[model samples]
Target: MKLYHLPLSGHAHRAVLFLSLLGQKAELIEVDIPNGAHRTPEYLELNPFGQVPVLEDDGLVVNDSNAILVYLATKFGRKDWLPDDLKSVAKVQKWLSVAAGEIAYGPCAARLVTVFGADFRADEVIARAHRILKLIDQELEQHQFIIGDKPTIADVALYSYVVGAPEGNVDLMPYINVRHWLARIEALPGFVEFPKTAVGLRA
Candidate 1:
């Protein structure tokens, strides 16, 4: 398997973390997003959206962090990460949606603004990020993991940005449960630290 990624992208980090946790191996190809590598003709042919974290496996190309999570969990991970039960599956799907929807707009967008100096509607984005974090904190108060007792792709999908929220000037300290939850995710086997700065991309 080959993964095209940007080292500092939380979306890309999600895939890296999943592969690491599952003890799966893949060749990593760093994409220079700032240099428009993702937009090159060769790369655009792989993913029209020109996004990082494109996974190539056995001639199949998958993009989008959450989509990649689903594919990996279904194809490679244990049943606990992508359950076969109907209700359990729906629960997992719910969190994945939250990860893609609210998490994307809030923490991810804020990080882009801080790290890349991307123009964003600051107050709106920060407030939206906090709203999502508050809900997540409440959810964590009752559950050890997102869906069930064990960690799942849902946890992997949400972990990166939420853990990196402070870089965007969004404090997780206000959410006690979330702080503990982040610690729990960090304690998982094979977990790797995310680069603290955009310049730390090589790590």
Candidate 2:
């Protein structure tokens, strides 16, 4: 398996971190988004969306970070990572949606403004980050993981941006449970750290 990614991208980090947690030996191919590498025709052939964190398993190409997590979890991990039962699958899918939607527009967008000089309004994104973070904090206060007792791809899906929110000026300090949840994910076996950027509030 090969993962085409950017070092500082939270989306890419989520994929890479989950791959590590699954103990998969995959090559990391850096995509230089800053240098227009992802916009190249050759790169677009792999992912028409021209995004980092595209996965190639043999000849099969998979784009989108959350999709990659589901694919790899189904292919290699135990039931705990991605179950087959209807209820459990839907539960996992819900958080994956959050990771792609709320989390993306929230913490991820906020970080993009500071770290990559993206044009998004920082205050707006930061508020969105807090809204989602508060919801996550409330959810996590009662459950150890997003779905239940065992950690799933849902947890992996939400980990990166939430942990990296501080870099976006979306402080995690007020959400103690969320902070602890981040620590719990860090303590997981085979855990990998997302490369931090000294920007925003973190700067």
Candidate 3:
């Protein structure tokens, strides 16, 4: 297995965390996103989308972070991480959507603005992101993980950007439950700390 990734990417971190937790080893090929290496012809052959994370398992190419999470969990992890029950599956999918949607636009995009100086209608998007965070805060008020008691792929999928919210200038202080939930995730075995952004992206 080969994982083509960028060091700073939260999406890439998801796969890294999952592989670590499962004690699975894949050749880590660091892609140079800053130099447009992902856009090169060589990388384009691997993934047309030119995304940071393109996992090549055997001969199969898997793109998309959430999809990778599902694949890894189903292929390598215990049933606990990727439950087979219909309701459990649906619950996990919901948070996967949250990770790709709300978390993507909020903390991820905000981090982009800080890192690349990319124009990100910050005023509008930040507010929308905050609303989503508040909803997550409320959800965490009663539950330890996103889906249930034990951490699942749902938590791994969402953990990166949501945990890195502080770097995106999104304050976690107001969301006490969310903070507690983050602590729980961090406390999990094989947990890894994300690198702090050096671009002064924090609020």
Candidate 4:
């Protein structure tokens, strides 16, 4: 398996970290987005969106970080990463949606503004980040993981941007429950960290 990624991308980190957690090895191919390498015809064939973290495994290609997590967990990871039961599946899907929707526009967008010089409104995105964090932190106060006691793709999907939220100038100090949840995820076996870029509040 080959994972085409950019080191600074949380989207890329989620896929790569999940693979590591599963003990699956894949060649890391750095896509030089800063140099417009992702815009080339060859790269576009892999992902028309020209996004980082495209995975190629045994002639099969998987695009999108969350999709890759679902694929890898279904194929190579334990049942715990993504269970088979109806309710469990639905629950996991819920957080995945949060990861894609709320988290994406919240902490992720906030980070993009500070870290990548994106033109998003800082106040708007930062407010969004805090709102989602407050909700998740409350949910986590009762549950060990996002949906339950076990770690799932839902947790993986939310981990990166949340941990790096401070870099977006979205202070996490107020989210105590969220902080504990982050530590728990880090303590999981075979856990790997996304590279932290010093920016925003940390800067």
C-alpha lDDT of residue 34 in model 4: 91
Report the C-alpha lDDT of model 2 over 1-203, residue by residue, as the tens digit: 89999889898998999988988889999998888998999999999999989999989999999999989987885687998899989999999999999999999999988888899988899999999999999999888888887899999999999998889999899999999888999999999999987887788
Model 1 per-residue lDDT tens digits across residues 1-203: 99998888999999999999888999999999888898899999999999989999999999888888889888974787888899988988899999889999998888877888879986777898899999998888788887756899999999999888777777777999888888888999999877786321212
TM-score of each: 0.95, 0.97, 0.95, 0.98
**Cα RMSD (angstroms) for every candidate in the order listed:** 2.8, 0.9, 1.4, 0.8
Candidate-wise lDDT, in order:
0.87, 0.92, 0.84, 0.93
Off by over 4 Å in 2: none
Candidate 4 error regions (>4 Å): none
For residues 120-142, write the lDDT of model 3, one tens digit per residue: 98666667668888999888877
Is candidate 1 or 3 superior in lDDT? 1
- For model 4, how does the per-residue alpha-carbon lDDT over 128-192 read when each residue is reduced to its tens digit? 99999999999998988898998999999999999999999999999888999999999988899
How far is 26's C-alpha from truth in model 2 (Å)? 0.4
